[model samples]
Every structure is written in structure tokens, then in C-alpha cells.
Target: MTVTDSATTALSQGWCALSLLHGRIETHIERALQGGHDLSVREYSLLDVLSRQHSGVGGHLRMQQVAESVVLSQSATTRLVSRLEDRGLLNRYICDTDRRGIYTDVSEAGLALLAAARPTNDAALREALDEAARDPKLAPLVAAVENTHHDGRA
Candidate 1:
């Protein structure tokens, strides 16, 4: 027998719905960034975070810090940074205070790429959000997602 929305179930519909929504948004952002800018959403996020590190004198972040900020595993973050470095988009260096710690700062090229891609990325997100808001059924889901982000729980 097949179960439908009217049937009793053990699964949480809310969680499943949110997970699907997240997947769709992720795909949308990934495609928009990659197709238009030749950059992945993860790469854009990394560059964006590095560019915002004004608290650091040289606008750098430790590799660990970058991993945490970008929600990438340490090894994955290292590889991604290496890829960006190879593209001349960023520079990796050893921290002055901690010889074993590595840090990365966005290069001029990285900043320019991010600047160029920002509009495309922003437009895609705005369009997705606007569409969600227009759908009465999806509006609450979008609101919940926005609230989590604003509350720093995202």
C-alpha cells in the first residue's frame, strides 16, 4: 500500500520539506555561480568570507577558521583553498604568530572575481526568494529559513 499526505506516517514532513527546499536552493545557487562566473557556490562563499576579514590586519583567516566559516571539512577546505591559490585568486601563508597554522587572504584577482559574481549570485537568490514568497504554501518555509539565518543558527 502507498502512503499519501492523508495517511498516517512516522516521518516528519516539515524536516523532509525543508531538506528538499535546501537541496533545490543549493542547486540553484551552484548553477548560477558556476554557469555565469566559472565559480562554485563554495568557492564564492570562501572568497566572500576571506574578503570580509577586515579584523585581520592583512584580511586573512586561519585555515581552520576558514573551514568553520565555510562549513567545509578541514581537508576539503585546504584543497579548495589550494585550488583558488593555483588560480591566483588567493594566497596562503603561515601565520606569523603560529608557525604551524596556515592562513589565507584573497588576492586582488579574487576580489575582482567576487565583485563580478556578486550580482549574479544575488540576483539568483533574490529571484528564488521572491518566487518562494509569492507561493503562499512556501512562504512560511522561506520565513523559517530566513529566521534561522538571522538568528545565527544557520
Candidate 2:
């Protein structure tokens, strides 16, 4: 095959593999949610991000930062945060330095919920990891995908 044809073939296969992986992860997250977590995958991701930021940054993250991490539009993030705030899972505060900026932090109840869900989340992750480990060739591909940052960082 010509170089161009070979490249196209490789690209197609890579896309297929990525789609399959995405579907599998979504399935795992769905299973966890249905098993009594009471939180969707996106909500869990938001909580996780807030928890990490709070622990590292001494308790607050800008709306933009959280939106980027969760792959949501700014408006969508605002709505999601509002829902979480209404549910007592998070607290939003106006930034004194920048009136236009807002910050979000996990609430105590949110932390408790996250703690309760940790075991299930860990179990799902472990299963995925185990499957990857068994497939020597797939392990590196998975790692590379995980480590990839799509935020314009080189």
C-alpha cells in the first residue's frame, strides 16, 4: 500500500479503538451509577475535580477551570454547578477580586457522597486496568490516551 493509504488505514483503526474504549468506559460508569450512587458520571467527575482542587488549592476553583476539566461549555458548567449547589453538593461564591469570576468548592455532604462512591469507582477503574494489563499492546495505547491533554498544551 502507498504511504497515504497506510496512514489512512492506521487512522481508521485508531478511531475505532478509541470509540470502543469510550463505549466501555461509559458502560462502566453507567453500571456504577445504577448501583445506587445517585450521581451521573458527569456529576461524579465534577465532584472529583472539585475535591482535587480544594485539596490542592486550599478550597476553590474558578468556573472556567472546572469547565475545562469536565469538558463542558461555560454555560453548561454554570448550570451544572447550580444544580449541584441546589442539591447541597457544592457551594459557589463570587470572587472578591473579580466580580465576574465565580469559584466552586465541594460541600461537606458532597465529600461524604464522594467517599461513599469511592469503592465502586475504584473497583470499576481496577477492572479496566486489569483488562489493559492483560493486553500488553493495549496498555501503552490506553496510557497514551489517558495522558493526552487536549487543552492546547504541547
Q: What C-alpha lDDT do the candidate models reach, one value each?
A: 0.84, 0.79
Candidate 1 regions exceeding 4 Å error are 1-11, 55-60, 134-137, 146-154
Cα displacement (Å) at residue 87, model 2: 1.1
Q: Which candidate number has the best TM-score? A: 1
lDDT of 2 by residue, 1-154 (tens): 9999999999998787766666676678668865868887788889999988743444567777788989999789889988989999998777776799777888999999998887888788657755764665466667775566344454
| Alpha-carbon shift of residue 13 in model 2 (angstroms) | 0.8
The true-versus-predicted C-alpha distance at residue 21 of model 1, in Å, is 1.7
Report the C-alpha lDDT of model 1 over 1-154, residue by residue, as the tens digit. Answer: 4676435343465666667676767778899999998999899999999899864475667777889999999999999999999999998778777799777889999999999999998888867776766766567888987789899995
Candidate 2 regions with alpha-carbon error over 4 angstroms = 55-59, 129-154
**lDDT value, residue 87 of candidate 2:** 96
Candidate 2 lands at a TM-score of 0.78
